[model samples]
Target chain A: MINRKSAAALIIGDEILSGKTLDTNTQTLAKHLVRMGVTLQKTETIRDSVDIISEAVKRLSESHDMVFTSGGIGPTLDDLTYEGVAKAFGLNLLKHEATIARMHEIQPNLVLNEARLRMATLPEKCDAIWTGGLWVPLVCVHNVYVLPGIPRLFSSMIESIPSDHFGDVPPRERKILWCDLAEGDLAATLDKAAKEYDVAIGSYPATNNDSKKLYRTMVTVEGDEADIVIAAAEQLKGALNARYGTV
Target chain B: MINRKSAAALIIGDEILSGKTLDTNTQTLAKHLVRMGVTLQKTETIRDSVDIISEAVKRLSESHDMVFTSGGIGPTLDDLTYEGVAKAFGLNLLKHEATIARMHEIQPNLVLNEARLRMATLPEKCDAIWTGGLWVPLVCVHNVYVLPGIPRLFSSMIESIPSDHFGDVPPRERKILWCDLAEGDLAATLDKAAKEYDVAIGSYPATNNDSKKLYRTMVTVEGDEADIVIAAAEQLKGALNARYGTV
Candidate 1:
């Protein structure tokens, strides 16, 4: 049977919305989720607001099997991931002694002031997935995994997660074919093939930035059945070539 | 008065969600919106599914002053933006002669097959915003603006958008200060300053990939009142310097 697990990403940070920082976490998470046979269905980027965070988490969690949240987990005033997630689940925010211990281990000489200690507070009934030494563990509350927004930290934490966390299934097979013709000219064939085949097909009309080719159409087919997906791709290529000549 | 006409982006594409393509449209739009004094409140990346597209467009259109959508407007089987937005507004899809004429102008030598004609279909009761010749005009349905997914095309379309569309206000003033100290150590002070001043402050802890400094904290203050925003920045800087010498 095909794996049906679906995931969504909630990327929270004022910096991203202000265009001060570029978000790579969504793309990173999507790649990993796909590797685990889970489809990343949607991603939302919002500011560091508690109300927005809580509402998005609640809604996404109800619809998806897993929801990953990146950012607002730091020890700054704007970091409200713990509080917002707790409010969403109706849980109290409590200090995690283990997290505090890990923090001390990371920076033994640093003072554990109120601000530094803030990172220790997490939603009640949450579990921490410790990746390795000196790094903060990823927090898991219900179906949502709270991750740091820092690209390096987020990537490392995700790397440490067991590949089995998202379950397993037959890997999806995809094949892409390129045609020089306008995608509009091939839309009817694509529409017909999509209905007849069991594969999901996508047609992209792209303009090369530096290449001599002004326009190229990319047709992609993805499905669990490799043979069927490949067949669909080949059929699409044939139709495009038949009408507009191959690129 | 401050311009509070905020907007949100709906980036629709399977390539983005499947980790096949990186989405830069969100950042591009955010920067442009900020320059025009329109805050980009949120952005969502969803699949090419008609149901998902319609729901997101309808919901965001109701909440935001303006909603911009990129992708899924092409002439492919998966290109459901026209159909989706129409469904959301309870409008019928109709063939527009102007759009058809423009398509022909863009490719005068090509035959207008059923697939090619698909590009002429659009939602009724909508107005077109033509940027220039030979390009498909951006469609405006209610508060939503549908645009192409191609980066070059999207950038050009956005740039061609009337500057007066978002309304004008006193340009926001921003000041960023970098500190070598851990952001956690300065959270409390940052929080206090944000409440005391009529400015928004954000603390970002970043790790330098190629610099000697392992970590640097970025403190940003932004507001319509230039004096208040700058004062907040200076105050925060003084507090940080008092605690840890400036970098």
Candidate 2:
């Protein structure tokens, strides 16, 4: 079966909104998806509201091929990922016997709080995969995979997911070149090369705080084909060298 | 005059999409707007596309009370913020004579790389304020404000925005409490207190990493009134303590 290509990530938390924390999951997931040959089209950060989470899940799942949500899956009252996922899929959340059993194995002295047990509840019609060392399963709803908000846990959970689970992994490559020349000085040449190679070129400039006189510009070339990507990168490096004497 | 509340934030970069960077600007702006009594209900993140940036500006300005964009204001090829803002407002991206003069004054020996000077270009219809330091101008388009992506710079830029410019600020009375009790165990108490006090309660549960025996529950109480917020918070604390004892 030919799987769809688009994906989206929803990061749920009030901490993110409050500027109390910086979210790393979205970027990590986006890069992972890109490598998987999936196009990450949209990313949204929403407050921990069941209504909002449910709405976002339903809408994104319907529109995109895959949807990944991070955060709000803990045992606290603010963790409403399970409830939201259930509501989104119109499924009843019941504690899974297997998950409860696994929890006991992981923590023999674990005191079963009703809130913590909430983590064991999975939406109907979904398969759950345990991420990291956590005993609770990361529930997968349709094409939506719910992961924890913790960066370490999120990374581990993403790794646990088989590449083939999403679909065929497409070949993607990136090359970077650093130059002392400014971007505007190379805009025309870079734009011309980008069009010619059908590649994407991203130029980032940074000022050296130490010297205050020297500036470094990094140009990134990315595409699906290795030959095209390498060729475009070489072209960019050559153009930069010709335009501005080599550093 | 009853000034309507509106605002927008622009995030410009490929780092955001590539998952190399998680944007904290939206959340920061959202919370700030909420504190300022500005209804920040919508936000979008787009690449460093001049066309996309211009279109975002036009649409957001037409609907929102204000628009604030973070990123794409740098001195790189991807930094299309100035041109984008100009196009959106049908203004010319000309070197602001005053701003250029200030730049020369601040950094006399500054090799005005056309790229570095790119930072001085501003839309004709907007006012510019120096945000990062003495030379960088924070361009303001009507109600829209353009900011840099660097966390410190973004925060400083926002702080420099006078509250009077945005009309009445949002009420900032909010309180938080931690409970050892599970959310489901205290659901009834929380719901009853919320309804009685007419306040909003958000519960977040986290698993204990060390013991994994008890789940840490964080309850947030928010309202327009200080007394009501405190009262609700007290009720939640009392109920959780009664049920599961103190944390």
Model 2 chain A poorest ten-residue lDDT run? A206-215
DockQ of 1: 0.57
Q: In order, what fnat does every candidate score?
A: 0.73, 0.35
Q: What DockQ does each candidate score versus the true complex, computed on alpha carbons? A: 0.57, 0.32
RMSD of each: 3.5, 5.3
Per-prediction TM-score: 0.92, 0.80
lDDT of 2 by residue, B76-171 (tens): 566788888889888887778877888888878777767667778778867877654567677787777888876667777887887887786555
Candidate whose lDDT is highest: 1
Residue-wise C-alpha lDDT for candidate 2, range A1-247, written one tens digit per residue = 2243888788888666654456678888877886787777667667788998999899889988888998988765567878898899899988788789888888888778765677787787688887656775777888899998878788888888877876776645778676777665766677788789967787755532223244466677878778888888887878785322221
Per-residue lDDT value at A28 in model 2: 81
What are the lDDT figures for the candidates, one per model? 0.82, 0.73
Q: How much is A133 displaced in model 1, in angstroms?
A: 3.7
Winning model by DockQ: 1
